[model samples]
Target chain A: MALVELHDIRKTYRVGDQEIAALDGITLSIDAGEFLAIIGPSGSGKSTLMHLLGCLDSPTSGSLVIDGVDVSRASSNQLAAMRNAKIGFVFQSFNLLPKFDVLRNVELPMVYAGVPAKVRRERAMAAIERVDLLHRVHNTPLQLSGGQCQRVAIARAIVNDPKIVFADEPTGNLDSHTGEAILTLFRELAESGRTIVIVTHDNGIAARLPRRIEMRDGRIRVGVEAAVSATTPLISPAHPGEEAGA
Target chain B: MNFWFGLLIGLKEISAHKFRSFLTMLGIILGVASLLAMFALTEGVARGMRENLAASGGVERVEINNKDPSEENQDLAFLSPGRTLDDAEALRKGAPLVSLVSPEMNLGNNTAISRSNITIRLATTGACPEYLEVGKYELAEGRMISQIDVDRVTRVVVIGASVAGELWPDTPDYVPLGEVIRINGVPYRIIGTLAYCESDAAKRKRAAGFSAVQDERRTRRMGKKKRVNRYDTYWQKNHAILVPISTLFNDFRTASNADGTPNWKLDRLSISVADLSLFEETLNQVRGVLERTHRGIDDFGFDTREEWFDNIESSVRATRTSGSLIAGISLLVGGIGITNIMLASITERIREIGVRRAIGARQRDIFVQIVVESGVIGFIGGILGLLAATGVIQLLIALSPAENAPVMTLSSVVVSFSFALGIGILSGLYPAWKASTLDPIEALRYG
Candidate 1:
């Protein structure tokens, strides 16, 4: 069975009598251990899709199944539990808590998961070591470079051993070399059997991933249906939604 | 998340803005301090007033005095010849619930008393032997006047501490036990000395029983050292000399008509009843007898110490209630200050709240964090307030002329501290609720 399933999902936001659809009629499924990227231009609803799939929000009308449980009608507490136990998220701004040191920032997910202190410390340190930020474990985010901050965000996402990691432009603020380094870390994490879903506006960033879905006008325009065959090109031509290659 | 982690987060936020936190807490500090100080002062006044009342025969004793002639009662006063020993004797026989009745005749102040070169103008009073127990007086040396002294009309005297110090100033350890002192050009033997100064013996007596007269000596010593005026009502007993009623009548009863008819004259009558529960009934019966003795003219009035005590108590309570109300307003202002600052703090940390919410923090967690932060602020304010109040109380005691100034009790500290903490929780409710209701998507997007 798919690890995450969205059946014709729709999300509408109301502003002053106009009902704007941030995500509409997007039916998709992500299997376990799949590495996928959702690529879109501005106002393409990729962030709203990530929000729905990651349980940060519920769809206006749709059935969402994660790990064989329907989460569309989930309570806030149940949604929080799902996020803590089954999913992890990284943001474009590298949302590391500015007050916490590197190790503490990584330990946050497990802290919410009610993990014991001793076990949380050990797992957080292991995740930090995996991201190659072991030397800066006690340093706050203000004392770290942009690349190191992104690495800390990656460590935080994986510390709870979540089934899927959702990263939205995780290297958006970094230089080219640091962005490549962060992408290499994501590649290694995906190779280790963790499902990774990244949302980005850059076609070059999307070309580096294994499977890609291009979104436009609140729907999947191209590339998700046949991309499941596990082999895709380094760069696809300018399809209907592949405006990034223009 | 666990409570310790939440508390640590709260502390970190407060420490990050130390001056703001301190300013937010200043109102609560002043409120708590003033409330506690008022409690201490009112408590002291209550204690002092009770002791003062106890010194003059306590709440159970009653005094009957001659009434002034008012516009409506002038005819009655003229018809009555005033209270006398005959009225006192009649009350003793007619009132069954009455215990002791002592008639008093006070010679006017500045009565001449001399011993060799030393002379003093003191107030003197004439009374029977029962005066010693009814008036709450204790003898420091020798003996009080006996029934024989009254029956035989003996000329013997009991001097106060002031009299002893003045007449026998040269004697290092003065004991006027058997010495003779002249009063109004007539010689009288000093039979006893009143206990006007507190000594180890006084403490022992106080511990042994409820002798309210001991309070008088203590009050005088605590006050200034200037000579107490003989006309002062409460302190006059500290500067008086007592003699037998017969001696006063034989030598000092000088008021009479031209035909040599003696006036029926007495200054005051102190009555100690057998039981305070039956005091009203007994007082009515005494009034009846006195009225009949004076030929149906009500020319006398009475007062009880219990009534005096009640009046003082209610007045003090009024002052205390008003003081507490003022302090309560300050506490309210302090609570509002906390609410305002907490709301501002939550607004500034909206993104942080969002980040934590995305990391699986429940709404309850956010609520708990904000409330705990406000509670910690109140707890800190309570401690500092108690310290400041203690310092202020000490300064007041040092500057005041009274021997004892009020100090904060442990109960007041605990009460005020707990009240302050409750204010914190109450004030934090709206702000914490506002914080907990924020949407993660919207909060994260807040600048």
Candidate 2:
């Protein structure tokens, strides 16, 4: 089943008397377990597409169906609910609130969701452990290195068991080695059948994902002939993290 | 977000900038303290004035004094001969509400009353029999100055408790019913003695000049507070001495006295009403009769305890209004300070707000957080203000003498505290709304 389906999505913004198109026309679909990356240069509207897919914003004129629910008419509050329930966002800056500790940062999504404290704690701990930063749960974001902050952000994202995780340059601020380690974490997450989408400018990282799409002038450069290739299972679900390091 | 979460955030915000928050709260603290203190001081002054009103002749008593006639009637003032027995007599006849009339000829102060070698200077008033009721005095023994005493110009006197005590200090039980006392070498018989009254000597020591009595017994009382709880509340009444006006006619010595014309000059005329509530109306009626007796010269003025009472009440009211206005301005300034700080804080935290929104926190959640932060500032300031008001009250009581000590009331505390809390919340409103209205996309990208 497709986890996200966008039909002719368009987003426009007006600057004084000029109308600018951030996302012109894009139709795309991603299966529930597919690991994909949307790659483009700066000003190609890839970030706008990521924002629409992540439910951080609504398209100006388009139909967005997430987990088989039509979210085209969702209000800002309803969009917020959708974001909390089904979508997780990882920003380029590893936007963990500086004042909160690692454990508290992981638990914030559930805190807004009104989840029980005990359950939120257990799930946040599990997500932190999955990111291999369980030892630093009590340390604030400012105390952690760039990669550790990104790991905490990832933990926060997956703690809710969201249907799709959209990471926008999750490794942009990290060292090359640290960036590779984060990529390895995403690989392991994908092998576990987690639907992960990366929106990045790094072509090398895009090439490594199971499916890849390129955007230019707010339009995806893809044809119908490659739909099967993009939708195919890229990682064997049975192995989980066996080939994570490889 | 839950209310508890919002409260935690609010408190954290305040703790983040402790000095700034305290400075902001100072305005509210002073406002609340001054507000409550003003109420306490005004209440005290009002209470003291009411006590004075009750002591000096009470609400139902009116005294007519010689007021120089107006500029228009200045020429006719000599024709009226000032407030006299004739005006008192006319009031007695014409004004039905004037229940008691006491025409007095005051012989000034420090009139020496002597018995053999011992003598005490006392305030002397040549009064009528009705002076007892009009002055709110009671005789312990013997008769008051009767009409026959006035008609015959008899040399008789009525004395206060302090005078009787000083004249015969060794004889505590003596009631000198027929004893002859001399006034500046002039002989007169004591026809009555006022009831014996004494208070804590410590109070009298503190109030050295308050009484004319030189009794050494006042200091014998240990440090204790006891009110006499009677009509003789004023210390002046305790030292009162009265003689018949006719007996002291030559002492006052109006120009008509030497000419042998019937002298009717009186220093003042006291009028009493049976109904205390009808005092204003009866005073007006008595003034009208006095005007008629003076043939519209307007040479006399009606003096009432109500004027003193009213002066106190109006002054207290003015103090309260101006004090509240000052306090209100301070509270408003305090509120503005909160708003200014909150807005600055929000501007600094725009990115954090965006991050929260991206993580699924709603605008309403952010709004609640900001408002709760301001509310915490107000709530804490309110409690502090209430405490500060208590200290202010104590300071006032320490500074002021007795009878005007400040009284702290529960209502004053509640009003100040609640008002502080209300100011806090109200001040947060615009800033909270400003914070919640920020666009997530723009805020997230803000530098």
**Candidate 2: stretches off by over 4 Å:** A102-104, A114-139, A145-148, A159-161, A176-194, A223-246, B33-44, B65-105, B113-122, B126-182, B186-239, B242-266, B276-301, B304-311, B386-419
Residues B1-447 of candidate 2 have per-residue lDDT tens digits of 878878887887788789988988888888888889988988877776676676567788877777778999887777776777777778778999878988888765677889999987766888888888777678899988898999898999888776676688777657888999988678899999887443333244357565424433453244344343324455557777788888887544545467766567777777888787787788788778878878889877777777777888899899989988888898999899889988998999999998888888888988988999999999988888988988888888778756677777788778878899999999999999999989888888887
Best by DockQ: 1
Leading candidate by TM-score: 1
Task: Itemize residue pairs with steric clashes in candidate 2.
Answer: B201-B218
- Candidate DockQ values, in order, are 0.58, 0.56
lDDT of 1: 0.81
Candidates' chain A TM-scores: 0.91, 0.90
How does each model score on TM-score?
0.86, 0.76
Lowest-scoring 10 consecutive residues by lDDT in candidate 1 chain B?
B197-206
TM-score of chain B of each: 0.86, 0.75
Query: Candidate 1, after superposition: displacement of residue A13 in Å?
Result: 1.1
Worst 10 residues of 2 chain A by lDDT: A237-246
lDDT of 2 by residue, A139-187 (tens): 9999999999999999999989999999999889988999999999999
